[model samples]
Target: MADDPTKKGPADRTRVSTSEAHELRYWSEKFGVSHDELKRAVAAVGNSAEKVEAYFRDRSRDARR
Candidate 1:
C-alpha cells in the first residue's frame, strides 16, 4: 500500500528541550531552523514536541502571508 501522506513522519516532528549544545544542535538541524528560533518556540509554548511543531507551523503560515 502507498504511504499515508497525511501522516507526518518522525523527522517532520519537533522534539523540544532546553539548549543542551548537542541536543540543541540536533534539533536545530532537524527542523532546519536556528537554536534561537527553536528556543523561542519552546519558550512560547512548553516543551511538548507537538506544541513546538504547531508553533512553527503557525509561524510558517504567518510568514507566507
Candidate 2:
C-alpha cells in the first residue's frame, strides 16, 4: 500500500457511487459517525450522497422529536 492509502487518487469519485476506503473515512469524519453508520445511510438511501445526507438529517430530526 502507498504511504498514505487514504490520500485520494486523481480518479477518486464521490463516496455515493464508489465507497472507497478513503471516501468512507472522509464521509465518516464529515458526518461525525462510524463507518457502519455511513454504510447504513448509503444502504438505506441507495448511494446518493444527497439522499444519504437527508436520511441522516431526517433520522436525527426524528430522534430529537
Best by TM-score: 2
Spell out the clash pairs found in candidate 2. none
Q: Per-prediction RMSD in angstroms?
A: 9.1, 3.9
lDDT of 2 by residue, 8-51 (tens): 64132343633467667767776778899888788877876678
lDDT top scorer: 1
Give the worst 10-residue stretch by lDDT in candidate 1. 1-10
- How does residue 21 of candidate 1 score in lDDT? 60
**Deviation (Å) of 2 in candidate 2:** 13
Residue 9's lDDT in candidate 2: 47
lDDT of 1 by residue, 15-57 (tens): 5655456566666676679899989888888878888878888
TM-score of 1: 0.70
The estimated TM-scores of all candidates read: 0.70, 0.72
